[model samples]
Structure formats: C-alpha cells, structure tokens
Target: MLADSSSSLAHGHKGRTGLVRILFATRHSLAGLRAAYTGENAFRQEIWAASVMLPLALWLGQGWVEKALLMGAVLLVLIVELLNSAIEATVDRVSMELHELSKRAKDLASAAVFLSLVLCGGVWLAALWHRFVPG
Candidate 1:
C-alpha cells in the first residue's frame, strides 16, 4: 500500500494531468493566500503595505524598468513573508516545544523576510531620491 501510494504520488495522481491539475493548483494557491491573510498578522500588514506601494510604484517610477523593479521589490517581500510563514507553520505543526533546529529554521526564514524588506526599502528610497532630490 505504501508503494502504491508512492507510485501514485510519483505519477502526479494528486491532481491528475491537464486542466484538472491547473484548477487544483489554482484552488490551492488561493486557499493558501486566504489562510495567510486571515491567520498571519504580519501578512495582513504587508498586504496593506503592498496595496499602497504597488500603485505608488506605477506612478512614481519613471519608466518601464523602474516600474517593474519597484513593483517586483514590493511583491518579493510578500513572497518571502509567505514562505517564512509557511516554514513557521510547518515547524509549529511538527512540534510546539523549544527545539534548536526548529528555532533555527524559523529564524532563518525571518532573516529572509528582513532582507526582502531591506531590498524593497532600498529600491523605494532610491526611486524617491531620484525623483525628488536635486541630485
């Protein structure tokens, strides 16, 4: 039975092929977004930040490349945050006890999120300086 299940998994039996797989993937992605938004306070705050930054990215950017860079930087934060939240959730699901490995994993994920935020801030500041400052 284990072999059968493993073989089925190897063959992509979870969502099958073609349109069914695409639909299932889309559904799962939406569910993940919903779960993150509803369950994660940090995610909710980032969503609000993105809501403001995305439009500002469009308006403040001087050209297509600037716009893309600004927008991508903002989105990158949310992506990193989602991954960080997923790691924390998985670690907690495994065990709520104070384990060094789990703590390390969560901390590393958090650092990734912090780096993404730094990158986003740098991009935005550069753009703002370019637009407003007399340099």
Candidate 2:
C-alpha cells in the first residue's frame, strides 16, 4: 500500500492533473495568502509595505536588474513571514502549553523573518545609495 501510494504521487497520477491541478494549487495558494493576511499582523504589515515598495521599485530602479532586485527583496520578506507564520500556527495548533522545543521553534522562525527583513533593507539601501551617490 505504501509503495502504491508513493508511486502514484511520484507519477502525479493519484490526484488532480493538468489544468485541474494548477487551478487547485492556485486556489490553495490564494487561501493561504488570505489566511496570512487575516490572521497574522506581521504578514499584513509586510504586505502593505510591499504594496508601496513595489511601485517605488519600478520608479527608482535604474534598470531591469535593479528593479527586479528591489522587488525581489521586498517579496522575500513576505515569503519568510508567511513561512514563519505557518510554523507558529502549527506549533500553536499542536499544543498551547509552554514547552522548550516549541519556544525554540517559534524563536527560530522569528529569527528567519528578522534576517529576511535585514536582507531586504540592505538591498534597498544599496539601491538608494547607488541612485543618489555617484562614485
């Protein structure tokens, strides 16, 4: 039974396929996005920041590479935040009781979000510096 199920998944034969799979995947992704936005303050804040930064990226960026990098950095924050939120949600769902391992998991996820924010800030700062200061 395990072999059959594994093989089915490996072959993409046990579930939705083709356009149907794509549609389902897209729906699921949208639901996740909605959930993050509704339930997570950090995610909502980052999303709002992205809403502003993305347009600024297009305007301030000197070229395609700069624009892509600037936009990518902002998006990275959102991605990391979403992952962190998922981890936190799963930990909470498992047990509300205080546990050392649970604390570690939440702390690690928070650290990941912080690092992503730092990277995004660095990228934006570099772009601003390059735009305003000539060497």
Candidate 3:
C-alpha cells in the first residue's frame, strides 16, 4: 500500500508538469498567430496587388528606379494602413463612447489612409505611362 501511494504521487506530479508544458506551448502559439495576423492583412493585400502589377510594372516602368518606386509606394500604403489601424485601436481602447476627439482622430487617420492609397495609385499610373509610353 505504501509503495502504491508513493507511485501515485509521482504520477500526479508528472501529470501536472505535462499540463503546464501544454499550456505554455499553447500560449506561445496564440501570441505568434496574433502577431502574424496583425501584419498578415497588409502583406496579403500587397502581395495580391503585386501579383496583378508586377508584370505590368516590369514591362511598363522606365527603369529600375521606376520599378522600385512603384513597389515602394505599395509598401508605403501598407505601412500607413497599419498605422491607421493602430490609431483606431488606441482610440477605441481609450474610450468606447462617441467623443468628439475620438471621432476626429479616427477620421484623420482614415484620411491619411486615403491619401496614401491615392499616392499609390498616382505612382502606379505614372510608372505605367513612363514605361509603356514615355512623354
């Protein structure tokens, strides 16, 4: 009876250790996934856009500089979008109410996103024109 009780206690300790290990692994995995998702949206969208534009830019861009600028514009838009998201998140965390300052801040962040998108479009058009049919 004594030996059996001692073995049971050791078994219980092992069980506890295993549970802790599993929990730690799960936590790390979740944190990694959250981080990946945070950046994944921008990366996925930009890559999709590139899939459409890479060939066109390669053919239509005036030179390496033009190609670089076109790609860089897309990256810049993504950066701005991420920043805008961060701003909205921060505002929401600060307060969920309909405050004037929160509204203004979100609106401003949205405007910045729009401006970056517009710049991206303008760069693409310019690069395409310069590459396909220069002035």
Per-candidate clashes come to: 0, 0, 1
Q: Candidate 2: where is the Cα deviation over 4 Å?
A: 1-14
* 1 versus 3: better TM-score goes to: 1
> What's the CA RMSD for each of the models?
2.4, 3.2, 12.0
lDDT against the true structure, each candidate: 0.96, 0.93, 0.75
Residue 89 lDDT in candidate 3 = 79
TM-score of 3: 0.62
- Sort every candidate by lDDT, greatest first: 1, 2, 3
Which runs in model 1 stand beyond 4 Å of their true positions? Answer: 1-15
Residue 1, candidate 1: Cα error in Å is 12
Q: Is candidate 2 or 3 superior in TM-score?
A: 2
Residue 13's lDDT in candidate 1: 62
What lDDT tens digits, residue by residue, belong to model 3 across residues 21-61? 68877887667546645565754576578677767666666
What shift in Å separates residue 5 of candidate 2 from its native position after superposition? 3.5
Given candidate 2, what's the lDDT at residue 102? 100
